[model samples]
Target: MNPHNARIEHHPVLGTLPPRKTIRFRFDEMIYEAKEGETVAAALLANGVRTLRLQEEKGTPRGFYCNIGHCFECRVTVNGKQGTRACLTLVEDMMEVISGKPFSSPLKKGGNHA
Candidate 1:
């Protein structure tokens, strides 16, 4: 589904959102459009992207959880910098975001046991 389809243009409580300039950003080498001033996590969710990163130890998928920046589940690499919180970072035109990968953990099955 497209971001437009996933976005909530109207809400009963907040009502319809005002028109905002559309901006383009890259995520995982894929380009997507988002409203100006939108957070990376919000834009990703609007584009039907759920998996933000993988758990460092288990290599399990992670997405937007506890979006208030308290939990680092939405961490992603922005502009070549790692550990940027997707829920807190704003999308910029031509910005590049890369999904984070799990680090090698000895606790993981089949992982290096040294």
Candidate 2:
């Protein structure tokens, strides 16, 4: 193996990547500006919203592990609902997002409602 040959990929789907655009979203009561074509989860992660979900046991911090939706780690409330796959959701201006307890977090860190 050639150590010097190693190259890091910015995206898993390298090549033919589309240009990013600007979009807006509302998490809780605050609005956030993000790029278009970016996954809701990805944008959230980039915006420092690492704590996405709440732990069922004691409201511990839960964050995304897999960018893919199969992990269910990025599950969040979208437009007032539960089981939303943030990684799969696209950003649309005025989109509403919430974290914890399907709408309210018993241990919400940022005052997010259930």
Instruction: Report RMSD (Å) for each prediction in the order shown.
Output: 2.9, 9.6
Model 1, residue 91: what's the lDDT? 96
Pairs in clash, predicted candidate 2: 21-36, 103-113, 103-114, 104-113, 104-114
Clash count for candidate 1 is 0
Candidate 1 C-alpha error for residue 64, in Å: 0.8
**Each model's C-alpha lDDT?**
0.91, 0.73
Candidate 1 positional error at 108, Å? 7.5
Which residues of candidate 1, in runs, are more than 4 Å off?
A: 1-4, 106-114
lDDT of 2 by residue, 1-114 (tens): 322222232666676445566678988677776777777887786666888877765667788888887888778889877889899998777789987643353565667556
| Residue 8 lDDT (model 2) | 32
Which tens-of-lDDT digit does each residue in 1-114 have in candidate 1?
363448888999999999999999999989998999899999999988999999887789999989989999999999999999999999999999999898876475667788
In candidate 2, which residue ranges exceed 4 Å CA deviation?
1-19, 102-114
Quality of model 2 by C-alpha lDDT: 0.73
Per-residue lDDT value at 5 in model 2: 20
